[model samples]
Target: MISQVRSELTRYLRTETVGGAILLIAAATALLWVNSPWGDSYFTMTETVLPIAPLHLDLTLADWTKDGLLAIFFFVAGLELKRELVVGELADPKRAALPIIAALGGVATPALIAFVVGFGTDGMDRGWAIPVATDIAFALAVLAMTGSRIPASARVFLLSLAVVDDLVAIVLIAVLFTSAVSLLWLLAAAACFGGWALAQHRRISSPVIYVPLALIAWYALHEAGIHPTLAGVGLGLLTRVRPDEREDQAPATRLEHLIQPISAGLCVPLFALFASGVPLDGKVFGQLFTDRLSLAIILGLLLGKTIGIFGISWLAIRLGIAERPADLGHRDMFALSVLGAIGFTVSLLVAELALADVGDGSAVELAKAAVLVTSMAASLIGSALLLRRGRVHRARHEARALQPEE
Candidate 1:
């Protein structure tokens, strides 16, 4: 019975729609829980501190989910990124140019818009980074549900763009969030990376060894004042993706298969539960539109993402710098841009880091609310557009099928 339940859960977790559906449910539960009459309990649960005295670690429930569970999600992201760089869509310069360019355009325009709007605002410095990330799981979920008649290359394009966006977000976290560094601890983290790479090179696959090593690396990065999540990315990239002559799968593939279900079904959803519990009062709603910080985030996501992604993609294709996916039209690309605007996971993480030092936690809360609002709006708009475009493609396919094979 237990194995049957486990098998069912694994199947569910492997589905694109299921992961995103669970994430949305988690976020909604958090929102409702924080606003209910028992709201104090929600706050209490998230704020309660847990300390590991030996390791000098003291963190709240929210922090643990963000710092620990979210790291696993990033680890899966890192593995996908490494796979792409080594053997997937991003392996060739000619094939890679379109998504890479779109990703850059996506990042730059949102940042520029946010900075321009919130130039003199207190959290502007960090808040500008929030809308630059595209939540891969969420975007892919919408695609799978609404774009069944679309070409497979559309999914490839979206995944590649999101992966590059993840890389940019990682760099930003490492560069912007670390205010001070302990060199000795940093060196310890580096040593951990060395050991991880060595393990990969030697084909050592013991969980006992790698698990503790990963924990130590995370701790070292935390002590070094770096965002400890980068440890997951580092270790994931170092894992071998190519299979040996006698092997069915490489270490990266095995780890990803083991870890991704846990990440999608548990880790990411838990982080959303903890991190997305912001209070949604009338004052917050007013601030979302009137306040520069929230306004910047919303506009950056809605406008910056749409114009940047679609515009750059069109130009690249027209100039012959990049090839367009066969049978997809300008309308489909526009829909993709709108979908790309749904920046949920990494955007929320950025909101926390960016406004962590801002006054009274209000800025952080507002930034998060803006992300949520923008993501919802993008999802709705993009889904509608995709559904309409899908019908057109479906009609074309049906018409072609009805005609005699010629």
Candidate 2:
């Protein structure tokens, strides 16, 4: 059982790591495409609208990428979170408390920092939530690629921190972005969710049963003005994790294994390709320092995320509220905290939702640019720290291997 579990984790990590690389390449391509002489083509491509009259949805390619494609990513996130809560690190309250507190700190501190820096600014009210998310896919990808000798428990800790942090961000997104709630549609969405839970209870594992229900739920939530992505999360969380006597894996595990690649490779990269193409110029660069919104986002991701995640974790361990995972040291914990600063996927989405109301699109562009720049820097710095720590771990492993039998 242990070997099987480890194999599953290895598979998950491998998929996410490859996906992260694709996501990065896609983002880089977006940057270059948007700046090329034919830059208008990039904008045109994202701006092109597809009319779904039957569903009463007419959305741009970018909107589909953000609202639609990213929903799959969130679904995968929900599955991971549910699995963690049920059988993973979060299964034990004692084990769970550290990352939970750290996640809260991660959210609170960066938001506080952004609020302070961008106080009285136009988008600050909504934009402060920008840095609260840690893109688990990207962050774990970095660890998988760079921290070869790092303990599995360290990866587990980072995953827990990021999953919990992203959960909070999702709640904030749902609350802060809802313009108006249609009661009827909300009721319909609720009905769908109810049916979903019922299906799970009855052990109905057919895709035919789930796919239509998920689609209807998504549509209902969209019409209800509560970001439809919540549908994916709700469905994912509802999926059963414990396999039956004759089953190899639970529905949740099976579904995650199937959909993770699609979410990571296609959904996320496509979203990044559409979302990361912020028209590059001197004005955008200038605003990184002079503009309060941009500066606030940058500082919040870099300094605030580091301070909040690492500080709370240290305090928790010292207070004996939670035990640190074995084979992980303070230096390792610190490096993991820094990795929490890599906010990419949902950060860009929040940048869109937060600044959508403003007539001037420049603020939105600047905010995203800040996110891209900050995430890149955090990845580099965190990777370096983790790599150094990894070498120490490798040496320790080698020493253990060389030791004589007792």
Best by the lDDT measure:
2
Every candidate's lDDT: 0.88, 0.90
Instruction: Evaluate residue 62 in candidate 1 and report its C-alpha lDDT on the 0 to 100 scale.
Output: 91
Candidate 2 C-alpha lDDT tens digits along 1-406: 4555557667777888899999999999999999999899998999999979987799999999888888899999999889888877788899899899999999999999999999999988899999999998889889888887898888878888888998999999988999899999999999999999999989888889988999899999999999988888888898888788878898888998999999999999999999999887998888798889998999999999999998998999999988888889999988988889999999999999999877678888999999999999999999999999999999999999999999
lDDT by residue for model 1 (1-406), tens: 2343234323432454567878899999999999899889999999999989888789998999989998898888888888778767787788899999999999999999999999999978778999999998788888878887787778878888999989999999999899999999999999989998888888888988799889989999999999999998998888887788888777877887788878887888899999889899999999999999999999999999999999999999999999887677999999999999999999999999999889999999999999999999999999999999999999998999899976
Clashing pairs in 1: none
TM-scores of all models? 0.96, 0.97
Q: How far is candidate 1 from the true structure (C-alpha RMSD, Å)?
A: 4.2
The numbered model that scores best in TM-score is 2
